[model samples]
Target: MGQTLYPAGCVLDRTGKPVTGFAGMGCEMSSEAIVRAPGAFVPGARYAQHRAEGANQVFVDVDAYGEFYHDYSPDHPMTMMRDRDNRLARLSLGMTHYQLVMGSENATAWSAGVVHYSHGTAQAHVSIVWKVKNDKDRFGGWWPSDRLPLFFKTFTPTEDEARLLFGAADRLPLFDAVFHDSVIASDRWEFGLMKVSGMEGARFARALLYGTPTIWPLDRQEVRRTGPWLKAAHDDFRIAHGWNAPVALTGFRWETADRLVQTTSFADGRTLTANFSSTPFQGLATHCVRVKRPEKAAIDLCPPALPTR
Candidate 1:
């Protein structure tokens, strides 16, 4: 599997700082912060928790197949990530935008666009997403006014049960993201900066130059060669979309602005493509997940109550 293994990676600052503090995440006596938001922040927001299908984790490994286990409530959506206190983070983290794009992908009985199905029971789902800034300011809140990024619905995959759902020649949950040193506007591929290093300390750079990993291992010829190639691809994917494509992706190719990444059609309802762009990297980073039975159902998705003032 020359394809890289999927691991949790994060974006780092030039000084190698990984954890970023939200300058306004929890501002006191401020009408601008979401945590202190009026009507937006629910009182005792921490005490409420919700669930579904006898599970609470959004991504559950059931019988080796995955499904979105809901613990969501009228007060909170169980799909987003939780913070230190085992409670939802106050800031509308990436999940907020991710859910908006996934509204159309929900396979649950309640989704509107979904054709109520009769089969292996709409067991799992995945949403392919791309987020960029836009000029829409309608929500009437701080989150809406701060020049929020625009998230587009690239594609959505709802699987019929969870076997053989992965492999070549079909749309797999793993998104194929490519990182180019330019601005990209399509989901066929993504490009971003390489802020994290892999097994070897060979950090891939954001430019066409500085592009080689001189720190190759003394042994293992294949690792030495593939490492740099993989690093460059990861950087481009992150830079273009503010996120990283799945590392284990196979069966996709290079696409670009003029001729960009060509799209691949598959049976599992997922699309794959590559990208080539000419925009420089921005101050953002992202990581994509091949969620099994993703819990993006709108019928039961809502953010938790915001912590009180």
Candidate 2:
């Protein structure tokens, strides 16, 4: 849980206006789940919609990351739920899910991996693993085996972006990049799991939201665009359903990226640049680049030079 601000006496900037926008202090979480039902799975299938003849299982998961390794302990509610699930299953159920909620500063964080049985038999299962941490720390902690067993590469959460970067070498773009790639890679090793279970789209959603339909335009534009189509569609949908948008739900921006270098400007006069690079051996990688702010005035008090005579 987090605190809310009141505008009556909220902290303001030099202009005396109420401070607006995120303080660059927040968290990012991601989740990935795979469900398989023995030999009945189909390979290379799109499963977002239910066909008239049959229905496929669709799973939605949540994840978080923190500033340190210990953030995965039982103190956080999400983590506690995961640990409790682990203790009860005792390997019989395996791990199925992950949750993470990191707050501003290294002071608050939580993470966990979970496993559970799907269908009537234990043959079907789900696994979710995640990490949460403070916003500023660039190099996240090492991978722990308390839940899913795989080595996650180092990563830094991006500020106000639709993507995440990971790996020690050239930061290869992990598509949407919020979810850990190692978990997905490990999931691939399961028994013909991806081909039949219609898990491809599910996994795709974990990295890229709206998958190719939305991403293709982003790929072409290399920018996020807001459109009247969204507003029109939203209003039309509301009218059709006799439902209105939530008071707090302002709107969403459609975004995409194809360039290596990108910059983000904050409402508080702070700007962040994402620098990316690639090597023949290492492939793609990204590093934390800081923005240099203007320095204050300084006095020049050098003594007068000695007379040439």
Candidate 3:
């Protein structure tokens, strides 16, 4: 098969509507939207391990489709990258689902979004994102603080502050994140530079700019492309939101001559593995699997339990 050069696309809203432009738009759909549209959500098989353990956990894995998986914990959201030396002040905890923005040639950039549904509670949050415009290197985009979890709701950074924190030239990149949680906790979240390569960054940029992946109601027949760009945008969403943990994804479990990479580890007694395929067609895809229950013995062994008395 030949490669697609400058393939056309557009951005879709939660209600399956096209987003007209990039000017301060919000997600109109609600938590019920995800519940009603089962086809739009990722498969249950993809979440088997996490489902077995429970819904709320500090760390979790996400499948970016094709062949990529990454980790994230509430403590540090961007653990998959090298510059993840920061803490998470607040995080949206719930059953999270992602979507791609595909439309006609009217749009000019790449974008994706995430909707978080609170488990055992009637609350949900949403985030629509895009890559920074005019940036030639690294991965970092503009994310609106409009709907952040309660604790950091007031976190409105100036253009310079946001650019410095994300290490991007554009103060406002793309995407709008909506966090809707009544309870906000006082937590620590630090901002740092994002670590990414030129090719990786450019590929993601191109994906957003060209590829047309399938979305809800709109299947492969509708989009007409495999949507590698959409997958890349989704992967970047995890990066921007700090969904993976750094300590857990430090090294590789295995790597093949064909450029397939895997990382496996044991955290809190549970077995976890992340897979990545660096091939050009499937480079941005991610798949993750977690197993077993957290080890009570490991928690008991922590030095904090020694007691100060």
Candidate 4:
């Protein structure tokens, strides 16, 4: 047994002094402390690296988890892999025993099998312009208004920003290829359905291409305002792609300077083709689509019925 029964300890800086923040809020307990003192479980640490130019922080690389490390204190020497395994084992046990569905905030590739759903994988972060223009308060305290702010409702990305934000170069569906059938991935709750207003079409198209669910932060007013479109969008996706079909194959190619086409084939033998070049394929742009199967009739995703607001 350790000297202290309480596993929690003060986090230290490179100089071996406690890392104290405003109102004494920066302290954290390491997993090894629990192991040594309580003989309980370990929880994984976040990824950290040494600052090449700064002396305020010194990095400790553990052998088990590569560059990741726990607190530098001698009493807290647990590796991140051990911690990760311990946490995931608990999750597995809960799922098995309670018939529960597991989910996490933003799941990495290693934790995909354990978590049933995840946010922040599909639409990660917004551009700096969007943040500055919309969220004047950094804490995201601008809710409970009459309607959505004008910037949130109508702000469209410029051509350069569009390419940077929603362009093919950075937008890849690698996560969906492996775990779309098992894990339901969606945008973060903060940036749910109506938040990405001008980029609605591109977001929906990408959701279809990636075979993930859409996240909507709905209120009574929002329901009244966008109800029909939301219903249609959900119905379209449910009908076209069910909740649990694996993506068997995918293809992406550029037909012309402005035109790009992507296809996602599901295990159920349906192939969805998204045409990005029918118009200016920018961040605020929309795409046309056609779904094909061996015996089923061709389904077209065109201008009228799809959600564009």
Best by TM-score: 4
lDDT of 3 by residue, 1-309 (tens): 011110111223334343343345532212122222334332333344455666333322111111111222222122222211111101111234212111111111110112221121110111111232223222223343442222111233345434333221121112111111211111011111111212223222322211111121224432243244344345533332223431221122443453333323322234222223333322323322222235532111000111111
> Model 1 segments beyond 4 Å from truth?
1-44, 47-163, 172-234, 239-309
Provide the overall lDDT of each model, using Cα atoms, as 2-decimal numbers: 0.23, 0.23, 0.24, 0.55
Superposed by TM-score, candidate 4 places the C-alpha of residue 126 at a distance from the truth, in angstroms, of 8.7
lDDT of 1 at 60: 12
Using lDDT as the measure, the top candidate is 4
TM-score of each model, in listed order? 0.18, 0.18, 0.18, 0.69
Reference-based TM-score, model 2: 0.18
lDDT of 4 by residue, 1-309 (tens): 234533345444455555453347654444345445544332211111112233222111121112233455655644557656644554554345434555665666766666677776676455654553444443243453755443234344566666665665456677777777777777665555555435666666667766777777676767766687577568768766765545554554444454466667777678776766545432223465566778988776643343433
lDDT of 3: 0.24
Comparing 3 and 4 by lDDT, which wins? 4
> Which scores better on lDDT, 1 or 4?
4
For residue 194, model 1's alpha carbon misses the true position, in angstroms, by 17
Per-structure clash totals for the candidates:
36, 30, 28, 0
Model 3, stretches more than 4 Å misplaced?
Answer: 1-132, 135-251, 278-309
